[model samples]
Target: MGILDGKNILVAGVTMHTSIGYKVAELAQQEGATVIVSNFGRAMSLTGRVIKRLDPVPALIELDVTDDEHLAGLADTLREHVDHLDGVVHSIAFANPETALGGRFLQTSWPDVGQAVHVSAYSLVALAMACRPLLGRGSSIVGMTFDATVSWPFYDWMGVAKAALESANRYLARYLGPDGVRSNLISAGPIDTLAKKAIPGTEEFNRVWGERAPLGWSTTDSVPAAKGVLSLLSDYFPATTGEIIHVDGGLHATGS
Candidate 1:
């Protein structure tokens, strides 16, 4: 039997086949989990088309995390597909390319910063609460993050947002722990996904990872990071919560 056999999982923020969420969804199914995928706006159509590649294509739902109505009715909507969720993969984040990222940290407006924090960080809590009714003992919540402990050349506000995400994860673990639920995040190395392309100086990240990552890093392959997410979602990490697992080829351990 697979690690996640008979589990119900919802993976949010899948749009393209190149995305980490896509890989997570694909692998989750292979590991015997019944996966439901979600996206919002125009990307929903892209997510719908891309998931068809899976054996029994997962159900795709629209979830704009920033919307109160969507968050409020999430569990009800989710009930249509599955009775309960064993895992929720929160793979959502966003920041304005022009004002909130790429060295414009000092100039970013509050609106842009708020949007970034709301989507990237706060949504983790929102998603968990929205799914709380369907979650029970042994349930897990996992989110994606870039290393937020240090600053990067062009990461700017998005870096700040990730830091918030890290902090929010801890709080979730603290509060959810009472219910036997776990919350954690995976801090991954740079991968050449569409989201990375939106950042102005993403190439610098690849160069740094290639130079410093002890195990080497690939900009194209997302499977390693995806695997990290799966591990957290599975029974393997039963007692681990409020933790940040790095899947960045050991780069986070290096000084330079």
Candidate 2:
């Protein structure tokens, strides 16, 4: 039997097949979870096309986390497909490449930084609360992150946003713990997905991981990170919460 058998999961922010979110949905379904995938704006079309490759195509929903209406109505929208959610994978993050990223940190406008934090960090709490009614004991809330403990070139404001994300995760665990809900994050190594392509100097990340990651890292392979997310969603990590699991091939552990 699959580890996630009988569970209902929502994987938000999926677009291309190469995306980690897509990989998570694919594996979740393969492991017996009923998966619903979501994206916003024009990317919804791409997500629609890619998810068809799954054995049982998942339902695609439009969710702009910045939209109060979208966040407020999330659970109701989800109910049309599944009675309840056993897990929620938050795979969403964004920052303006023009102003907030690529070493533009000091010059980035408040609006851009605000947008980054809103979408990348606060949305974790927003999404969790929106799905709170559907979640019960043993329900898992997992988010994706880059290791925000240290800064990286070109990561700039997005790195600050990720730091906020990491902090928000701990707070979510504190508040949601009372409800028996668990919140955690996966700090993954750089993968060459469409999202990564948008970030300037991504090649630098690949080079760093290649040289330092003791277990080695692959910019092309997303399966290892996806597997880490699944493990968190499964019953195997029942006692784990408010933690950050590094799936960066030991890169996070390396000291310079």
Candidate 3:
């Protein structure tokens, strides 16, 4: 049986086939998990089309984490898919164009910065709590993150958002650990996904990533990273809460 043979996983942030969410959900199914996908405002149609690409198309539910009405109904929404959930992959992230690129820290207005942190960071905690009741022992909450150890040009507010995500993940683990709910972050390297392409200076980031990562780099295939998520979803990481798994080909450890 696959590592996740009996796991019930909820994956968020699947707006397109090119998104990391697509690969995560696809891999989860291959690894024997019953997967459910979450769609946000305006992307519901695209999410539906993407589901068909999965081996056994997973159910889709509304989860615009930024919207209270949607958040309140998320449990009921997913009830249409499965009775309970064992894992959650928080792949959701967003920042206004103004806050993401062609932007500087000083130029970012509070509303823009606020939105960045809210949807990109705070939402993880909100989702974990929202799904807590459904999660029993051995359940997990996985969120995506960037190294963000250093400031990245053109990343502006989004970088700030990632930093918050990293911190929030730890806090979630601390609180949820008592309940047997594990929380962790995957610090992925520069990927060429649509999200990365939208940011300015992506070419520069790609160059640096390729040069620094010993295993080089690739955004074309997120299957390996998807597997890492699967590992966390399984019992393999029994004591791995609040940890940051680097799926960037060891770039996070490179000094040169």
Best by lDDT: 1
The RMSD of every model to the true structure, in order and in angstroms, is 0.5, 0.7, 1.1
Model 1 C-alpha lDDT per residue in residues 57-163, reported as the tens digit of each score: 99999899999999999999999999999999999999999999989999999999999999999999999999999999999999999999999998998999999
Candidate 2 lDDT over 1-256, as tens digits, reads 8999999999989988888998999999999999999998898898888998998999999998889999899999999999999999999999998889898888999999999999999999999999999999999999999999888999998899999999999999999988889999999999999988999888999999999999999998999999999999999999889999999999887798
lDDT of each: 0.96, 0.93, 0.86
Candidate 3: what lDDT?
Answer: 0.86
Inter-residue clash pairs, candidate 1? none
lDDT value for model 1: 0.96
> Model 3: residues >4 Å from true position, as ranges?
none
Candidate 2 vs. true structure, TM-score: 0.99
Given candidate 2, what's the lDDT at residue 140?
A: 100
Model 2 ranges off by over 4 Å = none
TM-scores, all models, native as reference:
0.99, 0.99, 0.97
